[model samples]
Target: MKHNWTTTKLIAVGAFGVLRVLIWLPFVAINISTSSPLLLIFSFFFFSLISVFSLLTIRQFGTVTIQTFVEWVLELPLPSIAFMPLLFAAAIIRALVVDLLFFFLRTKEAAASIVCGGANSLVLSALTYVVYLVMGIPGTQTIPSAIFTPIGLLLASTVVFDLGSTGGYTGYLVYKKMANTAVMRRIQGAQ
Candidate 1:
């Protein structure tokens, strides 16, 4: 696909990227402050909403390349490369999943958003688990723990993704309305 990265589009993408991180920071802090699975789950529900909203905004204003760039910028402050591979993989998978679904299903409804979001999260979570295993970071150590079960983690991630995507779909409709209204007002004013 040919990308038309005009200054306006780039700025919009970058601003949206920063907005994504800003929206997520508070939730991340909350997650860090508590190890409660229930809390995390609840927070994930909200995070999914915010994440999806960000995804929708990005998609509305830019392309997958811009989305991926935003993801990279979000991860730039990480202490190690532990999450880089997973993030990059997520970006590619998200784009492909959305594109393929868009092609076959030929719809941009809530279903598409939910499927794309959950698929992206699941792929990333699964990849992270595999990478963690291969790197031997918590291989034998945490495998015995209840929280470390692969299936549970994957399911949680998937649920979060689904919720977030649904939220994004809802948010897109709202944002588009507001945007259209603003544009109409500006046009009317010029006449």
Candidate 2:
């Protein structure tokens, strides 16, 4: 899709991107402090939902804009400096996966949202593991040897896929409600 990056659209992307970071930062901080798996999973859901919402709002290059903004935000903090490269790559990969899926699926319908969300989550998780292995991060071996097995991979994939799709569905519902409002229409230039 050849989208013209008008000033209005650039401003919209910047606005929505800031919104995404504002909403995501607290969750990330909490998850980092607590090291809770449940919080991590919830964060993924929120992340996907927000990304999808931005995509639906912008109607083009939404994921890319938000992901770039997110990486830029992370880069500013000293604590995240070490992980910036990996995080940036993962964010870009996830954005590409979602955008490409949207392109191939050719619709912003619930099903496409679900697939995009699921695929994005799955790719991120896979990349995390790859980074762990390549970087030889501590505690890599204790990830349970079974998880390397085919059955384990399948089970893990299934759970992640379900969580992501559920998130996507939730995002779609939220977008629908928001999109119906006059404020959202004005922001989207649909008015």
Candidate 3:
């Protein structure tokens, strides 16, 4: 198969970035304040394992994380297993998003992966800033979460990519490019 080297790379990096956020931040956030090693360890493993779904979702659909579908999921009064997993589903969508972007950009998967990772960092950091600003100061839940979230994401990304892959080089460039990709897709299509 004549692989789209550029697009594939981009997809990999981008997915890897989103993967960073979904898989890492929460565990870091939890570990920072709490002393429960068991809890921390479990959180780390669980989030890391969640990475599979992110890839699975992309393998199935060519869409980004269905934030809208997720919004619907929130409406349901499901228990932890049902609703919580749905929330983590964003990681998978994030991966799919990078793939979709690579497809449309007509680039190599490597570049897509790079773009995706960069996008994730920028978005993650900016999002962290925005939420903090919007809330004016950040309470207990928000305070620890804000500081640890990006850190957690970065940590998770680095760990998953032990060989020092995408997260090492292109992690910072992502958010700046977020505006760059706005022209290509509508972000959300229909319902």
Each candidate: how many clashes? 1, 0, 29
Arrange candidates by lDDT, descending.
2, 1, 3
Residues 26-97, model 3: lDDT tens digits: 654554447322233333233222222232223323333443244324435532222344334544444455
Candidate 1 regions exceeding 4 Å error are 1-5, 27-62, 78-87, 102-106, 136-158, 183-191
Q: List the candidates' TM-scores in order.
A: 0.58, 0.80, 0.35
Q: What is the C-alpha RMSD of each candidate to the true structure, in Å?
A: 5.7, 3.1, 12.6
lDDT accuracy of residue 151 in candidate 1: 86
List ranges where model 2 is wrong by over 4 Å: 1-3, 19-39, 81-83
Instruction: Please write out the lDDT profile of model 1 over residues 33-95, one tens digit for every residue.
Output: 553223333333333344444444433423444555675667678543424665466556655
Which runs of model 3 end up more than 4 angstroms from their true locations?
1-62, 67-100, 136-191
Local accuracy of candidate 2 as per-residue lDDT tens digits, 1-191: 22545556666666655665666677657755664323445556766776666666667755554555554664476454234567667667777878888767647478877887787678767776676567765444556778679999899888878887787778788888887787666656663
Give the alpha-carbon lDDT of every model: 0.49, 0.67, 0.38
* Most accurate candidate by TM-score: 2
Q: Give the range where candidate 2 is weakest over 10 consecutive residues by summed lDDT.
A: 34-43
- Model with the higher TM-score, candidate 2 or 3: 2
User: Model 2 RMSD to the real structure?
Assistant: 3.1
